[model samples]
Target: MAATIGTETGAVLVNPAARNRAAAGLRSIVLPLGLALFVLVAWQTYVTVANIPSVILPSPISIAKYIVARYDILLIHAIPTTVESAVGFLLALALGVLLAILITYSEVAREALYPNLVFFQLIPKIALAPLFIIWLGIGSTSRIAFSVFIAFFPVVIATTAGFLSVDKGILRLCRSLTATEWQVFTSVRFPSALPHIFSGMKIAITLAIIGVIIGEFITAQAGLGYLIIFATARADTEVSMAAIVVLCICGLLLYGLVAVAEMIANRFYSADSR
Candidate 1:
């Protein structure tokens, strides 16, 4: 009997590490997923239990069904907004990187413009969205310009930091080897700056989406923002919610794309996350 008891105790002790590892694996998966699942379940339950009108707050399932039913129309609106975001981001990338290079290369440029840049960043962008429409007219050009304005600052700040923060030792070695200014910048400074550029781009990408949507909200006839306005006027809550979901998905997709780009850059360049 004693021998049997000892065997059972040893078996229990031997399995504990395996049990712990299984528990950890389950936790790794479940912990993150659990919160989102809980939120969705709770949202559904609350709407059903309260007998809430769909006009007031449509259930998640209702919104999902509505999106499926109206996908053809939604796709029309989605394309314009996507185009605006992409164009704005591309412009921001070109201008922001150029500005960062200027600030790093020319002390005069930094001294003359950095203060104004900070002030420009501090001002509420939405308050000026209408002004942009007024100045540029109600078209894609104005919308793209507005979005670029919103995205440009983050890239400038982050990439400038990256350039400024490159290792002095590497810089000294470049100088010792009599590297040309362009060679030093291209080979050493730019590579070091990429991680920061990517960090800034991730932020700028999200801002670009918001800026494009805001520009559309200010003026436009054929985008997700316009769709929301039209639906709201008609008291079509389901359609409005469907448009909102599309906006959310678009934002997520943009951010994910930037993150993937960052990961790829990091892999190739061997960035040490500071």
Candidate 2:
């Protein structure tokens, strides 16, 4: 009888937590979809009622139709942009983390580079687009390099902040225990910095896409950015909107991948700690 009562108590304690997690997951999906549907409906109605010219603003329905009609072309262009963005983001992440470690460990590096980073941040990054094209010659090489440049700063700043945010008491404890710098850093600093690193990565992913699109806009060779520019120039607003919708989908997929990786890493870290 006692064991039965204990079993019932455990279920009571566990069930609500599971239910709440499920509820939260459902809300995350439902809310965004519901809101998007509402916006699309309103947009379609307004365009239809006002008899707005397609050149000025294509209805959402028109965009959907265009997507269905030319999905093959869109897919082909999407491949290059997606590759550039992902590769650039990964490169930026690696270099940024390395630089952050240098800055955190060496006071000289912090003093020498941090101010210069700030100065570079103040400069209009877009103005460098033409220069990148001139240097890299309107190729994916330029796009990827430009993206790395754009996305690099945030990761460095966030990761450095994360490294510095470790508890002073923990450092003192490690020192008292005679833990080496590498051991302390690997066990403590990097683990604590994971959250900040992921934050920077999320932001970097979006900025990476923006950089690639901007490059494509200038190059006008391929990618959804090129598609948008081409369609707009031709006054085919539906096609432009279609390209934008696909671009957005691609961006969201990349962001979702990052989020999934974060979740997996967090789980592994937690398991390792236990």
Best by TM-score: 1
For residues 145-229, could you state the per-residue lDDT of candidate 1 as single tens digits?
9999999999999999999999999999999999999999999999999989998999899899889989988789899999998
Across 109-220, the per-residue lDDT of candidate 2 in tens digits comes to 9999999988998988978987899999878999999999999989999999989998899999999999999998999899988999999999999999999999999995
lDDT of 2 at 81: 92
Residue pairs with colliding backbones in model 2 are none
The local distance difference test score of model 2 is 0.91
Model 1 scores a C-alpha lDDT of 0.92
- Reference-based lDDT, each prediction: 0.92, 0.91
266 Cα displacement, candidate 2 (Å): 1.0
Candidate 1 error regions (>4 Å): 1-28, 271-274
RMSD of 1: 4.0
